[model samples]
Target: MPSMVLLAEYVSINGTDLSDYCRKAELTTKVEEKDVTTYGSAGWKELRGGLKSGELALEFLQDVSASALDSIMWPLLGTVVTFEVRTDQAVVGTSNPKYTGSVLINGWNPIQGSVGDEAKTSVSYPTSGAVSRATA
Candidate 1:
C-alpha cells in the first residue's frame, strides 16, 4: 500500500513557526533540457540536462502581529532566508522527512481579499542552492 500525508503539516522560516498561519505550500522543481542533436545517421533529436531550479509558493492567512508580519515582510521584501518543511507536525526531533534550504523572495502579494473572503497573502521564493531532504 502507498502512504499519504496530510496538508496540515509543519513549516518554519528562519526559526519562526508559520505552520499555523500557512494555508497552502507548494514546492516545484524544474530542469532545463538542451538539444544535443548532431549530424548523425539518426534523424531524431537528442537532449541533455542543462540546469535545475526550485521554487516555493506559500499562501498564508494575513496576520497583523509583529512576529508574523515582520518575519514574512522582511524576508519577502528584503533578503534571502532559510526555510524548512516537514512531513509531520513535530518541530524538534521526529522521524518525518524534512526539506531545508535557502531561498530568495521573488514575489510577494500582501493582501488578497474581497467582501466576504478571508484576508490572505501569497509569497513566492526561488531556491538559491540545493534543497536537502533528511529525516530528523
Candidate 2:
C-alpha cells in the first residue's frame, strides 16, 4: 500500500502551494494510520509520500483565499465526516503517472468523505452536539 505522514497542526496555506499542503508539527507528536481507524479509514495515509513527506514539488499557502484558488477544496471535506472511497488496487499515487500531492476533491469538497462509513457524520464531542454536517 501507500505510505503517508499525517501531522495535524495549525497550518497556513497559500494558493501557490495548494498541491503540497505541508503539516507543521513536532516530530515527536505523530498520528499513526493504525490509530486513525477510530475515526476514519486508512486511505488517507498515502498523503505522506506524495508531498507531505517532502517527496514532490508543491504549492504552499499562507492564508485561506477561496476565490483565488483554482477551486475550493476545503468545503468538500465534511465539517467532521469521513468516507471510504474506492481506490485502485495498488499504491495508487506512487504507481500512477499523474501524481502531485494534492488531495483530490469533488468540485470543491473532498471526493472521499469526513466521517464514518458512507459519511454519516457524528457530532463533535467538543460542541455538545451543536456541530453538524452541511449538505450542499
Candidate 3:
C-alpha cells in the first residue's frame, strides 16, 4: 500500500454528496474486548473480540442556504440516515473502497466559530447498523 494525501475525499449523507463542503471525515470501526480469563489461568489474561460497532465523524465548512449542509442535516436529526465515504472522488475499486452504513444523527452543531475563524459544523454520529465496505 502507498501513502494517501486525501485531497479529494468523498462523503455522502442521506444520498446527498457533501464532498465539496466536507473539510474532514473519518470512519471508525471497533470491537468490544471480551475477557475470557478463568481461574485456571496462572497469570496471563485471555481476551476475545465481542460485538462490533462503528462511527462516522464529519466536519464541514458551514453553509446554511437552501439545499446546503445545514438544510440537509437539520431535518435528519434524531434519525438514522445512510452514509457513504471513500478515499477519493473516483470510483470504488480495490484501491478505493466505499464504506456504507446507517448512522444515527444523535446531535448536531450548526454554528460554532470565533472571531476570524471559519464557519464550520462538526458532527460525530454513531452507526445504527452494520457498516459495510465495498470495492465494486
TM-score of each: 0.84, 0.18, 0.96
Better of 1 and 3 by lDDT: 3
lDDT of 3 by residue, 1-136 (tens): 9587989999999999999999899999999999999988888999999999998999999999998889989999899999999999999999999999999999989889999999998889999879999999
Order the candidate numbers by lDDT, best to worst. Answer: 3, 1, 2
- Output the lDDT of residue 104, model 1: 83
Candidate number with greatest lDDT: 3
Q: Model 2: per-residue lDDT, tens digit, 17-123?
A: 23233322221112223322323544543332121121111222323446533344355433322211111223324332222222222223223344553421111
Q: What is the descending TM-score order?
A: 3, 1, 2
lDDT score, candidate 2, position 23:
24
lDDT of 1 by residue, 1-136 (tens): 9887776678787777788888888878788999989889289989988898898888888887776754566555656888998766865464677888988866667668899989888888899888988765
Q: Please tell me which model should have the higher TM-score, number 2 or number 3.
A: 3
Of the candidates numbered 1 and 2, which has the greater TM-score value?
1
